[model samples]
Target: MNLSVEKCPRCKAALEVKENPSCKAIVIKACPAGHYEKEFHPALETYIEINKVP
Candidate 1:
C-alpha cells in the first residue's frame, strides 16, 4: 500500500493506507470521525528510449 506520509486533510489525524481488495492501487482511510477514504494510484514511472546519448 502506498500510504501518504502526511496528516489527514480534515482533522489532522493519522491516515491508514491499505491495498484495494481487487486492484493493486492503494486506498487511504483517514479521519475516523469524518468516515472517508481516498484512492491512491502509483504513477507509471518509466524511462524513455532515446537514440542519442548524453
Candidate 2:
C-alpha cells in the first residue's frame, strides 16, 4: 500500500500518520490543530480514506 501525508480539514494544519497496522486497513491521523481522524479502506458508509499527502 502507498502511504502519504495530508493536512487537517478543520484547521488546515499539517497531519501525520500515527498508525497503519498490517493487520488492519485503518490509518490514524493527528493534526497540529489537535484534531484526530481515522481513514479506512474498502469505502465505509461513513468513513473516507485519504489518498494523498499534501
Candidate 3:
C-alpha cells in the first residue's frame, strides 16, 4: 500500500486513502467533502496484458 499523502483535485484538501474492503488490490482515495473519488488499480496493466488473447 502506498502511504504517500494525496490532495483532492477539486478542493486541494487532504484526501482520505484506504484499501477497498472487498478487494485488497484496489486503493480508494476520496475527498472528505465529496468533491472527488477515485480507485487505484495497481495490477490493471498486468491484468490487461494477461487477458489479451492473440
Candidate 4:
C-alpha cells in the first residue's frame, strides 16, 4: 500500500487496509461503514494468468 493517507472515496472516512488473515495472497482495503471495498490479488492473479495454457 502507499502508506500515505488513505480515505474512503465514498464517505471520505478513513480506510482500513490489511491482509485477509487466512489468505495472505489477498489484500483488503475497505471503508469502515461499508461505503467502499476492494480486493487485490497482486502476485497470485498474475501467476495464474501467466501459467494458464492457451
Task: Give the C-alpha miss distance for residue 54 in model 2, angstroms.
Answer: 25
Error of 2 at 14 (Å): 1.5
Local accuracy of candidate 3 as per-residue lDDT tens digits, 1-54: 455777666677787875577998877777777776767778773321111112
**Which prediction has more favorable TM-score, 1 or 3?**
3
- Residue 34 lDDT in candidate 3: 73
Clashes of 1: 0
Number of clashing pairs per prediction, in order: 0, 1, 0, 0
Alpha-carbon RMSD to native, per candidate = 13.8, 7.8, 10.1, 9.7
The parts of candidate 2 lying over 4 Å away from their true place are 1-5, 20-24, 42-46, 49-54
Residue pairs with clashing backbones, model 3: none
Assess each prediction's global lDDT (C-alpha) against the native: 0.49, 0.59, 0.64, 0.63
lDDT for each residue of candidate 2 in 1-54, tens digit (9 for 90 to 100):
324556676676677767666745565666754665555555564566444454
Q: Write down the TM-score of every candidate.
A: 0.42, 0.42, 0.61, 0.58
Candidate 2: TM-score?
Answer: 0.42
- Residues 1-54 of candidate 1 have per-residue lDDT tens digits of 547565455566665665468876544444445444554545644322212112
Candidates ranked by TM-score = 3, 4, 2, 1
| Higher-TM-score candidate of 1 and 4 | 4
Q: Of models 2 and 3, which has the larger TM-score? A: 3
Residue pair clashes in candidate 2: 5-53
